[model samples]
Target: MLSATDIEVSLAGTPVLKGVSFHAQAGHVTAIVGPNGSGKTTLLRAMTGDLPYRGTVRLGEADIAAIPGWQLAAQRAVLPQASRIAFPFTVLEIVRLGMMASAEPPPERRASEALARVGLAGFEGRFYQELSGGEQQRAQLARVLTQVWDPVGPEGPRWLFLDEPVSSLDIAHQLDVMDLLGDYAARGGGVIAVMHDLNLTAMYADAVAMLAGGRTMAQGAPSVVLTDTTLSAAYGCDLRVNAAPDAPATYLLPHMARRAG
Candidate 1:
């Protein structure tokens, strides 16, 4: 399990996250959701050690800060919101970079398998820079996937930390990526995603954390956290949530949202 307790993060002397606590079990998809500037990404950065923070982030029994960089790389992989390559590189070459952190890297076939997983099977020889934004996102995902190819390592379960992973993809690709994450979790890997789409969160996330004012407003099962009242209060907009009769999911109606008087 991964857990953060009393997390406080400040950027340039301005606090961004305050007293936020979170927990995610392995073999589950945990989502962090909030309105813009709500510190969703800030907290993720803190967890990933990209930002300094006052808190304890534990990966299982060991503090993440105590883990060595190389060992940590083998334990987890992160996919940023966007990636840019200055020099032109082929998709296969970019994906193969993921193997650099491994003490004993897997065979070259892993990269091809990852590309196939992300729906980019035959584009390995193409230049990464020429790919569309959505395609680029998928390629980056493939890289991250190749980094932690196995869900369970010799030490324990591996983890994937993704920031707005499907933000650049179309609707079909969004579902495809989310389903892929779910399958990863099903195979005993931990998945933590910073999500913007609440509908996708409802459909895919096993646990949800809603942030507001740099604090966690709610954390629990989606059905419990994604409520009309909690969402309206956090987003500061009048919004309605409805349950799908045919599916075990919830959806928010943007048309039902209205401005305050």
Candidate 2:
């Protein structure tokens, strides 16, 4: 299990998160949802040890901060909201960077397999800077995929922590990436993503944590936390959640929101 308790984070002497607690079981896709400046990214960064906090975060039975950096990289890979490259690197070179932490060199096929998984099959020789925004995002995802190739390692179940992973993708690629994440979770891995798309979160996440005013307003199954009342309160808008008879997942209808005044 991955768990955080009483997590408080401050940036530049300003408090961002106030006593936030969250937990996710293995083999599940857990989504963190909140409005702008609601501390979603801050909380995720803290959990991944990219940011410092005054709370306890445990991955399985060990504290995350205490784990060695290489061991941590072996167990989990992170995909940030944005990535920039100064040097012009080939897609294959970028993907191969993921395995730099290992003692032995990684085989060429591993990188190729990761690229294919992200729909970049033969783009290995393409320049990273020349790809479109969505393609770059997919390439970055492929890099992380190669890092933790096996969802479950001998140490334990590995993890993927992504921040707005599909933010740059089109609808088709968005669904494809979400399906891949779902498949990873189904294979006993853990996925915790900071998501802005409520409908996607409802469809893909096994659990949802809603944040408002730097605190977690609700955390549970999407059906329980994605209600009209909770969503409206968190986003400060008159939002509605609807289910369609033809579809299996719930969808958000932002157009149905009325002026609150």
Candidate 3:
């Protein structure tokens, strides 16, 4: 549903990404995972078309840049890591704003449904700034959810980009958000997420793109990408990756930090 071909980026004359290319399929969850400074955030921005990037990015049949800004909002909904509003707006107000760029109606009824989807139903009238970080993240997810559902008509596929979506949440909330992502993909929406939790990615993502030093080191099924060699190289520590006995994927164990912690 979404792809980047030989894409590269630089900030202040220093390259941050070097010839990255990958595709996110429809009805599947794809995750970008790496250590700090691995260009995860840069890649997410490149996907969103907010930053200048070399090479081609295609969202379904049309070039990503060719899509009009207003139209692009309907084609894709983004929940960036920096989804904070300085102005004092109600949670519902912020959610409706996400649909403003959309071509659909003010998503009021849809907003409540979206809030409930993320388990934040009664928080409609709460101030955006008053909520905790995890609550705010769910609020942002509610906004994106409205956009996704709003564009579910003839538009067909809608792309969802999430950058470190679980950074603020406790374990339960993190799982809550991940489950929502899986549900979105299962419903035939395309999901591309930037995640730091390898275990979460393993549990949720159908495919994994391992990025390091601003380049894609590997991209494929979770078991292939989250290997011992790749994890050690990317993280500068010894690690082990083993299959989960109860599941179909691998689980990463950081032996070094496991001992330290």
Candidate 4:
């Protein structure tokens, strides 16, 4: 499991995250959702040890701070919000970067397989700079997957820290990526994602943590955290949550009419 306790982060002289805490268990997908400036990405950075903060973050039984860089890379992978490649690198070359964490002889096969998993099969020779935005995002995911192929390693459970993973993708690709992550969690790997789409969260996430004003407003099952009252309050808008008989997941709709005209 990935657990954070009393996480606090400040940028320059301004506070960004305040006393935020949550746990994302293995075999489940945990989503962090909030409005703009709500510090969702900041909180994720803290958990990934990318930012210095006052808190204790643990992966399984080991503190994240104490883990060696290489070992951590083998156990967890991060898919950032955006990746900028200054040079022209082929998809295969980019995916191979993740293999740096491993001491194995050759990772070409695994890299190719990772690309296929992300629906980018036969894209090994394609230049990353030439691919569209959504394609680039998938390539990045493929890179991360190549790094940590097994969700549960011999040491313990592995994790995927994704920052707005599907932001660049269209509806079909969004479902593909979410379903991929869901399968990873189902295989006993932990997944913690910062997401903006509430409907997707409700459908794919096993748990949701709502953030507002740098604090954790609510954390629980999607059904509990995605209530009309909680979401409306967190987003500062009147939201109507609907449940349909045919659909198992809840849908969130903004009642624009309720806004001051």
RMSD of each: 1.5, 1.5, 2.0, 1.4
Q: Which candidate, 1 or 4, would have the higher lDDT against the true structure? A: 1
> For candidate 3, what is the TM-score?
0.94
Model 1 alpha-carbon miss at residue 13, Å: 1.3
Question: Which lDDT value does model 2 have at 60?
Answer: 98
Number of the top-ranking candidate, with lDDT as the measure: 1
lDDT of 1: 0.94
Ten contiguous residues with the weakest lDDT in model 4 = 99-108
- Which lDDT tens digits does candidate 4 get at residues 4-77? 99999999979999999989999999999999999999999998888999989988888999999888988999
Alpha-carbon RMSD, candidate 3: 2.0
- Each candidate's TM vs. the true structure? 0.97, 0.97, 0.94, 0.97
Better model by lDDT: candidate 1 vs candidate 3: 1
lDDT of 1 by residue, 152-202 (tens): 999899999999999989999999999999999999999999999999999
Q: What are the lDDT scores of the predictions, listed in order? A: 0.94, 0.93, 0.86, 0.93
- Clash numbers, per candidate: 0, 0, 0, 0
lDDT of 2 by residue, 167-238 (tens): 999999999999999999999999999999999999999999999988999999999999989998889877
User: Mind sharing the TM-score for model 2?
Assistant: 0.97
